[model samples]
Target: MGIKLLSIKNKFVAKCLLLTSTLALSGCDDWVVMSPFGDIAKQEAFLINASTVLMLVIVVPVLLMTVWFAWKYRASNKDATYEPGWHHSATLETVIWTTPLIIILVLSGLTYVATHRLDPYLPISRISEDKPLPDNVDTLVIEVVALDWKWLFIYPEYNIATVNEIAAPIDRPIQFKITSGSVMNSFYIPALAGQIYAMSGMETKMHAVINEKGVFDGFSANYSGHGFSQMHFKFHGVNDEGFDSWVSKVRSLDNQTLNHQGYLKLEEKTTGHPVTYFSTVGDNLYHDILNRCVDANTVCMDKQMHLDKHRAKNAVKHKE
Candidate 1:
């Protein structure tokens, strides 16, 4: 009876240790980039893992050999051969330089392939593993305006806009046209894909899609100003029906149209603004913003540039 009780106690202790180990490993899921929810992010995760494993092939062996050689060649061990004058060996020299060069070449090739393959401007070819984007499937276009301390997402197709919130249907590709209202900012959603810069008077593009249905956090990855720390928004991934419902809900809101006048107010320096929806959005609003002319009386940068060029030509013609 005594032996059986001792065995039971040991089993209980083993179970407790197993549970603790499992919990500790599960805590690592907090690394959102490694555990992604979108196809593009998954591809990025693959690249990270591949690169780490490739480097570890050399790193792990070198680290272990360092300790092993130190122990094996200790001064206390008289059996170890002394090589005070044997500094150079043809075989050792070949390996010392050749290994790192080979690794560099391989990594370079991988980086070259990944750079083009993962370019944000390139449209997504596949939605997820084994799922090629069908020709008939439509892509969602989102215009992202990085405001002073908030994010404004405009859905061109739906003619609706939202502040500090965005959403898209799962398994459908999303194309983002991003620009800043003021200074430069980085538009990032970790569970989606890489961060792309948003600059005033310039537009940047990023293509991505969500494979999972959940709420993710979106934020400015770069520090812009005093309110930079509060420049966070919510990104929702839902089904087609849910997306439509969300649009309907926004359309039903009493918020005014997001025109140049409205945008001027939004661009003011403020932080921690709650999600607000606008039923109507100005056409070519994003274009106007990209040109740094979201005000009624201001000339767009493109038009201003053209006028300047024409003026220069006229002045030269007069001289002639």
Candidate 2:
């Protein structure tokens, strides 16, 4: 029996050591959430770390107390106290209750500040800590459509569209107006900012800026269907000149135009779509998608709601 127990313990210890070594060898760079690139992500990381440390301030002492309690009150310890009338002391109660209350108050204030500062709808005030956004620099607007197992990005400024890829110049603020053609999905580019939802028939807004000049991964953080695992996109942050060159290169494609017809075709459910570009895209395409009118046969949500409201007003007048 002793030998069997020893053998099991040895195997368990070996497995634990192997797992720890594997994690250590991979390096922390793989954990992008802990190592942030953009200002929003960096703030989020700081908040996470701050909360963790705050909680640990209480947790570490309690864990040590537990160990100390076990040894102090052990059966073999002759110095252990025995008090049948042991009720909670005022000092102990105050320490236990007041400590948590103080921590909660601090956390509440921290959360409130962070929430407003990191509101996805709020435009970024500064590109970096030292640089305030200039009044002359325009915020780039990108309309995003989450299709079935794919993504479509439309740049209204240039009247161009792309699938499974998007780009912006470094330190330039971007406003993303997002909606869905099919099921709900989360639009997340971890290197740039946090996740925001894209819902059908309604538009959502997110504002963020990429500080780094590199291609990072963007994907649907929400699971929709079987093809959800393969849904991914690339977010490229380049220099101003490189962005201009990229836009020009896309314009040079010259032939493809994404109108409503093209959109319906692209809306079909498929997986693992490669990067595609459209030289021209129909105006108000995103507005149509937001109103659930990408298909000509479908009635737009706003128009239908307006009609319903008008009818209700007429009925009330007649009743009076």
Which one is best on TM-score? 2
lDDT of each: 0.93, 0.91
- lDDT score, candidate 1, position 28: 90
TM-score of each: 0.88, 0.92
Return the top candidate by lDDT: 1
Give the alpha carbon lDDT tens digit for every residue of 41-130 in model 2: 888889999999999989999999999999999999988999989987999999999999999999999999999999999999888777
Per-residue alpha-carbon lDDT of candidate 1 for residues 83-102, written as tens digits (9 for 90 to 100): 78876789988988898898
Which residue window of length 10 is worst by lDDT in model 1? 253-262
Model 2 residue 285 distance off true place after TM-score fit, in angstroms = 1.0
Off by over 4 Å in 1: 1-27, 315-320
Evaluated at residue 99, the lDDT of candidate 2 is 98
